[model samples]
Target: MTMPHKTIPESNHAKPVNLRIREDVRVLIDRAAKIRGKTRSDFMIDAAYRAAEDTLLDQTLVKVDAESYQQFLDILDRPPSGAGFERLMNAPKPWQG
Candidate 1:
């Protein structure tokens, strides 16, 4: 008798990634994955995710808990201060011609 398998739920926000690497780099990737007992795709995805998380943490981001989230929502509910906006809007454009 065969055992029944459960189906995994699908994700809605999947994005396709395609990258080109040099031949030497491809060889190095295979070697690294073999040493770690992980597939090339797994290693690459893990590395990319770590790099992405680091980048987001280094930027101007507002992180908050549930209570703070409500406060944040209320803050955004108000109008903008027009901070640095006028300078950018009225700034002279460089000559492109």
Candidate 2:
């Protein structure tokens, strides 16, 4: 039995982006899009989105050695100190007056 395909919902796209590519690159993209049964725009949008996500994630994700990771956890566990505690204690509350 053939199952129905799930498609992304259509949204109002008001922005226009102009892309410049070599003819050979365009042909390659067209061929790949045809093979995947997607229009060139659909394929490019999906590929661009994936690339953008990976770029952002690469910047945000971090790897640390076990000792450094333990140090990080230790810092988080440390209590607020000195000036910060004094400020909190002296700060005026709206409920007081």
Candidate 3:
């Protein structure tokens, strides 16, 4: 005889998060979440995740020689590339029609 396997739900892996926020802050978050059609928990999670990524990015340090730094500045001083910006500017505007 074989034993049946047990199935686990995704919620089992999730941990509860508690926040002690001001009533005004809670209302503001609820408004923003409603505009985006997401539950308050989902909106808060997305915001917290993005903030974490930004915090991580801020910790990164790039090392470059003096010559490389000047080259980077020189590139920044140049005008925008001629790939498609010019063409887009000259393109017809439907709003005017």
| TM-score-sorted candidate list, best first | 3, 2, 1
Error of 2 at 33 (Å): 0.4
Question: Please, what is the whole-model Cα lDDT of each candidate in the order they appear?
Answer: 0.77, 0.86, 0.85
* Worst window of 10 by summed lDDT in candidate 1: 2-11
* TM-score-best of 2 and 3: 3
Q: Which RMSD does model 3 reach against the true structure? A: 10.5
lDDT of 3 by residue, 1-97 (tens): 8686332334657889999999999999999999978789888887887788789999999999999999999999998869597888889999988
lDDT of 1 by residue, 13-57 (tens): 877789999999989999998886778977777667778877988
Q: Which portions of model 2 show Cα errors greater than 4 Å?
A: 1-9, 61-97
TM-score of 2: 0.53
Evaluated at residue 46, the lDDT of candidate 2 is 74
Best by lDDT: 2
- TM-score of every candidate: 0.45, 0.53, 0.56
Prediction 3 TM-score vs. true: 0.56
lDDT of 2 by residue, 1-97 (tens): 8687445456797467789999999999999999979998888877887788779988996889999999999999998789989899899988999
Worst 10 residues of 3 by lDDT: 4-13
